[model samples]
Target: MSTDLQWLLLRKYNSYMVKGLPEGPIFSKEPGNLVNIHSHKYSGLSNSKTIDVSDENGVIQITTRKTASPHTIASTRSTSNIRARSGGRRALRVASAPAKQGYRPDLRRATLARVSALLAAQKEPKAQPAKKPRGKKTKASA
Candidate 1:
């Protein structure tokens, strides 16, 4: 069976099933929470922008802005050759491609929320079984 649902957490730490991409905020009932959504980029270039969303009583607010970097705008544009462009796209197929035309922050937030919830739900399993007694020593009594 497939583990790491939505790559939220490793199967060892995850137990419950969370939606791969929930239709609404993961914690729709909870209010005033924000999620960050960024484009998927491979290679030297990083995501150019981000979309942040806040939820208040199921009301979702969105904000989008370019990433702040010390580099000038002239240096930030895509300078990679066509082959490089194709290669980067080929990589990280699971990741969403950079929002070409536009990005819907609300939808992105919904998607991110699902992953976030799953990750948050992930809990560490206790190595020692409290209900059971301590294990015998490694060397068996002769």
Candidate 2:
């Protein structure tokens, strides 16, 4: 996925799940469990299964696991390709080609009738003709 899409996914994921947790842990080498990531500063608890993330007063320690959220993987797979095209460029191209003149008469006739009528009106004599100045600039005819 593109960096822009990744950033968008990160933002969306953070908005829905990361506000309660510290900002630094979101991008850490190993993220903890949901409780660890969403706990306050003073909720300290350390063990082999969890890491202690404490703030400056030496009082608040948030417990977290060394794992990512289940939603992260699922969301990435779902939105990676979708967000790539939303960057305002050539993201999606139709697989089917436009129906040719003799390919589908029913559809072609329905569409071309309107187009042909418009074209015929434009071709009438009243339409402006291409011309140039006819005096000095005119070359002698052979």
lDDT of 1 by residue, 16-105 (tens): 323346574221111112322211221011223433333333333333444346666554433111221233233222112233335433
lDDT of 2 by residue, 1-142 (tens): 4434544445434433434355455321223221333332211121112322222232222222332354663332111121222322221111011123232222333233322333344343776777866876676531
Q: In model 2, which regions exceed 4 Å deviation?
A: 1-97, 101-105, 126-142
C-alpha lDDT (0 to 100) for residue 128 of candidate 1:
78
Cα RMSD (Å) between model 1 and the true structure? 18.9
| Candidate 2 local lDDT, residue 103 | 23
Best by lDDT: 1
TM-score of each: 0.21, 0.17
lDDT of the candidates, in the order given: 0.32, 0.30
Off by over 4 Å in 1: 1-47, 67-100, 103-142
lDDT accuracy of residue 135 in candidate 2: 70
Best by TM-score: 1
